[model samples]
Target: MPLPLYLLAVAVFAMGTSEFMLAGLLPDIAADLGVTVGSAGLLTSAFAAGMVVGAPLMAGLARNRPGRSSLAAFLLVFLAAHVLGAVTGSFPVLVASRVVAALSNAGFLAVALTTAVPLVPADRRGRALAVLLSGTTAAMVAGVPAGAALGTILGWRATFWAVVVLCLPAVVGILGGIPAQPAPRGPAGGPALRTELAQLRRVRLVLVMLLGALVNAATFGGLTFLAPVVTGTAGLDQWWVPAVLVIFGVGSFAGVSIAGRLSDRRPGLVLAVGGPALLIGWLALAVLAGEPVALLVLVFVQGLLSFALGGTLITRVLYEAAGAPTMAGSYATAALNVGAVVGPLIAAATLGVVAGHRGPLWAGAALVAVALLVALPCRQVFASRSGVPTGPAR
Candidate 1:
């Protein structure tokens, strides 16, 4: 991949850290702002909601802008939002800042994905996306934990300040590293919103989007409540939670690395293997939640399957929606966040009816099973078009 792609990855890492760091800081934020912890949790939801709304909106608005310029602009907005968050004392202001930051983050990622793919050959697009998305996995492994530690030492505000500082290098990289590339246009030689929408109407493309949502829902549904599963069910010490999370994060990184290599040549096969693996992992977790050793091993495997499945789903979407790369990329962002939001809700609801921490695992298993079924038809599609040009579908 090109240096500009790595630069884009850096920006993604910074934004992803900001997105996930809030989970660790919620208690501190509640204490400082004199709000309930549940209320403070709304900040995470607000950020997700912003992403769901902003992805398509921002991509549409910037459809005619240069990709480099758009990325830089989004990063600037993100930086400003982090600054506002760090300095603000009012709870509403903090929430607003999160929404603004998420909007910018979503816009940056959509534009960045669109920009990064064209920088390499068509066959390498899957690997290129993996390089960009590895930033998010890196954030999970290093950035979120580091931000939490910083928040513990210097207060929650300091975490946001740290994010602001992190943004500087990404900004410089975006400005200096990326060359100006004209925004993509339709065959008629202009930005075609109608054409993009029409491209999204295809059955295969819609199925890929649905698959993305379902797989993410499965992953997050179980993961959102993983701390409880570790401490409550597995009988591990609270401190062990971090270690388990680190294992999962490392596994995620590994999974993405492997998936990137295979997705170009065998995307459908990756999905076929990964989706069922995820289902089995979740089922195993549900059945063996009481065994710490089993729980630990399953979590790592689950993380691997989750991310590998993610890479496959995204590659499929990009292939199916090649006619509308920018819009398709934006929609992928929105779909994933939509799943992120819904997954936790489903898991939370199941917790009341199902026994113990097994609830989330069972819920996740069901979601992944559905996703596997949905992905069945796409195998032939991928096999038939292995090296074919993924231009706009006729």
Candidate 2:
């Protein structure tokens, strides 16, 4: 990858770490904030809500702004949010900080996503996207686990401070790497804001994005309370949490890495194979919740299957949103965060009703089952159903 692309990845790494590290810190956050673990998990939803709204809103606001300036501005806001979050003792203040951080993260991601595409050839767009999103995968592999350790050794506040520090490199990278000029206007020399928002009305586009959301819902639902699952349900010690997370992250990185090679060429087949496999993995996880060894192994398997399916869904979403170049990344980002919002919310509710950590496992399985059904008319399904034209929606 080019140095500029790596620069973008560095920014993405910071954003992803800020977004996903919460999964590991929920317990500590809850204890410190005088809230339930489920309540602490709401911080994830808070961040997702900001991303859901901020991606498009901030992208639109910055559409005519210089890429380098807008990116730098976003990073500054992100850094400030983390500082405030780290210093505050109020849970509400922390929640508010998460929203602000998410807004910045969302804006940074939108610009980076659009900018990264133009830096690569048309045929290699998928590979380029993979490189950018690999920051996310790398966050899972390195950042989240490291943050968990920091929180464990110091406190959750230290993790927040760590994020503030981690973002410094991104700020410097954006300033030095992205070109200092506003995005070029459309071919007709007109802003495409109207055209961009109109793409939301396209049923095919919405449904494809829905597929992306449901898959994400499944992943985040299980992920939000994963620390508790590791220590509580699986009977593992608290210290084992980070190691288990590392195992899952290693699998997640590998899964997405493999998807990079396969998804662009055979998204349908990737979905066809990955969807069912992930669902089965979820079921096995719920059923095997009592076995510490099984839980550890299943977490790895689940991470692999989930991200492989997720990458394919995201690639398909971008394909469907091709008409909205400036907004394509926002739509994809929204789809992922939509899942993040709904997943933990529903999974948290399940915690009250279900017997143990199995609730999220069940919820994840059901969500993906719906995704599979929603995508029934997609390539392999319709082809299997006989003599139907190919499509990605119901």
Candidate 3:
């Protein structure tokens, strides 16, 4: 609802593009740097690893810093990493750049979410967060594809340069738009890492984090192998892959928009509905992959439930960890990345035993079923805490 939130979204867009564009540029980077394509693919893994490790580390490091200052610093470092990668053209340097960029990206996101939530009314935090996260969905829909096309035309280095350029406006926005908000303080009147860690230990918070991981694992496990499923199972032409992806992206955007509006008042309801909805979607995909029309429709529904569940889960975590906003946000990022890494491994293993393209779908469905079981008990947690809703102190 505020201008600063949009700026935060811009920051996420740049970071997300950097995270995903590597997928399209790996072949080019491998050829140019004289490395194997598989080696270049490691850059993506390195970025994910950085996000998983760096988020909590950076959050702790910046725990005492003002939100605006820390966010600006993170973006500057992110921009510098891209510039170095673009100019150096060395494979090792490029790999290092991705790690640095991912670290900074994690820091920016954790800080930005912490920053944005306090800027709005308590009831509006869900919408504010949704608006901020929509930037990533936008990146998936537009930024990655555009970067890929740009890499194809002007070379992959140029795409890095473009990311650098895209980051500049966000930096300026952080400086000019966001007011200085001091880091959150404990009851003792200073930032307390111990207190935050204690809050993180709560069973409610732990369950929420695990729930987030399961949701992501379910979605990405299948999504990672989407292209093959589209062609091999659905009997679609190669050209249909991108179109189907676009459809899924559109569904994701719609999901976020709907979930954002409802999460503030009915987060539990959203989760209850979305989690089961996702289970059904995955099960449908497992059975319907051979039917092209059914497969396409289910893919779109899966994307919708994936992101809708994601937003609701984040809202739940933020609520449950209301005592430690910064660390809570970092924990959320770490949980999601854990799923991102583990999901594909699970899918790959399932494919080894399962006979066809449906393995991923079956794997995803099983994960979602587990997530639903985990989610069922959470209603009591929310009920116990309902009297004192956790939100920013105005």
Q: Give a tens-digit lDDT track for model 2, residues 1-394.
A: 6677889888888888889999889999999889999899899999999998899988888777667888899999999999999999999999999999989888888877777766765545567777888888888888988999999999989988888888998899878876676455444533378987898998777877888899999999998889888888888888888887788888888778767777667676778788899999999999997799898899899888888888766666666666677777788888888998999998998998845678988999999999999888755421221111111110
The 0-to-1 C-alpha lDDT of every candidate, in the order given, reads: 0.79, 0.82, 0.78
Q: C-alpha displacement of 355 in model 1, angstroms? A: 3.0
Best by TM-score: 2
Worst 10 residues of 1 by lDDT: 385-394
Question: What overall lDDT, based on C-alpha atoms, would model 3 receive against the true structure?
Answer: 0.78
- Candidate 3 residues 1-394, lDDT tens each? 9898898898898887887666456557888999965466567667767888888899888877788889999999999999999998688888888889889988888777777776777667778889998988787677776776788678889989999999999899889988766555444434377877788768888898898889887776676667667777889875566566666767788888877987777776777788788898999889989999998889788878899888777777777777776577788887887777677667766665654668879999999899888778667754432322333421
TM-score of 1: 0.90
TM-score against truth, every candidate: 0.90, 0.94, 0.86
What are the runs in model 2 whose C-alpha is more than 4 Å off?
A: 186-191, 380-394
- Name the better of 1 and 2 by TM-score: 2
| Regions of model 1 farther than 4 Å from truth | 23-42, 89-92, 182-191, 354-357, 386-394
Q: So what's the TM-score on candidate 2?
A: 0.94
| TM-score of candidate 3 versus the correct structure, residues matched by position | 0.86
